[model samples]
Target: MEFIIDTVNLEDIKEAVEYMPIVGVTSNPSIVKKTSPKDFFKHMKEVREIIGKERSLHIQVISKECDEIVKEAHRILEEIDDQVYIKVPVSYEGVKAIKKLKAEGVHVTATAVYDLMQAYMALAAGADYIAPYVNRIGNLGNDPMELINELSNRIVQDGYDCKILAASFKGVQQVRDAFNYGSQAITAPVEVLKQIFANPSIEKAVNDFNSDWYDVYGEGKGICDL
Candidate 1:
């Protein structure tokens, strides 16, 4: 499974990429507004430099209309690099925009997907990745894992090239469920992902091993000293 960070914070991106196995970075208008960089393009360029060209960068488009969305996507590609995946909400216009962008061989990620139908529409429209709102879906009294499982089965059964890039996670368990249910990728906040190592038992195990080693080798001694 591919892990992607869902914040535009440069420091978070740098740290996560350096320590964790992050495959990409994703940002929405709200996320960008958190930092509110004066020069948006320049800020994104800095992000690109930090992650490098190997990791995917997903940038959401602000337009809600079909024509404007298409135009905005082109602008994002021009401002960023061509490899950047334009994040378009899976609305009526967004599906249209996805198709138009795909026709021209542009990388697109259909975001804000809450329903199976919306995801199917984006898949048919040729989105490279379709993002489902996990927490949002659960808040509505629906099961998000069920959606991921069914969608994953359909993708294989029908042979669609698209992938499930699940998003909107509130905790680490939700992320694990996404992958366990067949999501090919998930984008979550750095804090949430960092919790994977927050279990006290994990740290205790390491401490125990170190104590045993120190008892035999003496304090501050190493294998090189031996």
Candidate 2:
């Protein structure tokens, strides 16, 4: 399973990527606005440097029309590296853009999906990843896991090369359920992902282990001391 962090903060990306098993970094217009970088392309280049060339970096296009979206995708590729995944919302025009981009061998991630049919359309357009808004769907009084389960089943049955990259998470449980429901990847805020270790019991357990070790090794002494 791929773990992706959805943030534009350089410090958070550097720290999280170092500690977490992160596979990618994803950002949308909203995420970029949060940082308000003076130069968008330069900031993204820095992000690419920190993550290096191995991990994928997903950047979204702000255009609504198919033609503009296609142009934006090309610009993003030129601004960033070609390996970066161009994120397109799953819509009529977006599907067209995805098809055009895929035709040119561009890595495309279909986003803003809330329905099974939308995801199916993205998969048909040869998208490398399809992102379903998990929390948004749940907030709309719909069961997001149902969509994920059915989509997962459909992907396996249809033999699609696409992966389910679940997004819009609020808590760690949402992230866990996304994976449990067969999402191959998830992009969440660094804070939300860090919540996985928020339990007080976890610290207490570690403290207990350390205390026992201290009794034998003496306080502040470690295995290296030997």
Candidate 3:
């Protein structure tokens, strides 16, 4: 499973990659607005430099019209490098853009997917990834896990190449459920990911082990020191 960070904060991205097996970085206009970088392309290039070429970088298009979305995707590729996965919303126009981009062999991620039909359309359009808003869907009284499960089954049955990149998570459980439901990837904020190790029991266990080791090894002595 691929763990992607869904933010544009460089410091967080650097820290996350340093400690975890981060596979990619994904950004939407709302995420970009949080960082408010002075130069968008330059900032994205810096992000690419940090993650390196092996990892994928997904950048979203802002336009709503089909032709404008396609043009925006081209502009992003030209500005940020063609390897960047252009994220287009799963709307009528956006699906059209996804088809056009995929026809040209460009990497496309269909975003803002809320229903099974949206995901089906994206998969049919040959989108590389389909992002379902897990938390948002749950807030709307819908079962996000059910949605992911159905999509997962459909992908396997139809032999589609698209992978589910679950997004919009508010808690660690949501992340775990996404994976449990057969999502191939998940993109979440660094804070949410870090919480996986935030439990007090984990730290208490580590401290107890260290205390016992120090008591037996004579104060500050450790295995390497011995």
lDDT of 1 by residue, 35-142 (tens): 899999999999999999999999999989999998998888999899999999999888988999999999999999999999999989999999999999999999
TM-score of each: 0.98, 0.98, 0.99
Model 3 misplacement above 4 A: none
Compared with the true structure, what per-residue lDDT tens digits does model 3 show for residues 1-226? 9999999999999999999999999999999999999999999999999999999999999999999999999999999898999999999999999999999999999999999999999999999999999999999999999999999999999999989999999999999999999999999999999999999999999989999999899888989999
- Scanning candidate 2 in windows of ten residues, the lowest lDDT window is 217-226
TM-score of candidate 3 against the unseen true structure:
0.99
Model 2 Cα lDDT, one tens digit per residue, 64-128: 99999999999989998899999999999999999999999999999999999999999999999
Note the residue pairs that clash in candidate 2.
none
TM-score of 1: 0.98
lDDT of 1: 0.94
- The list of candidate 2 runs beyond 4 A from truth reads none
In candidate 1 the C-alpha lDDT for residue 212 amounts to 92
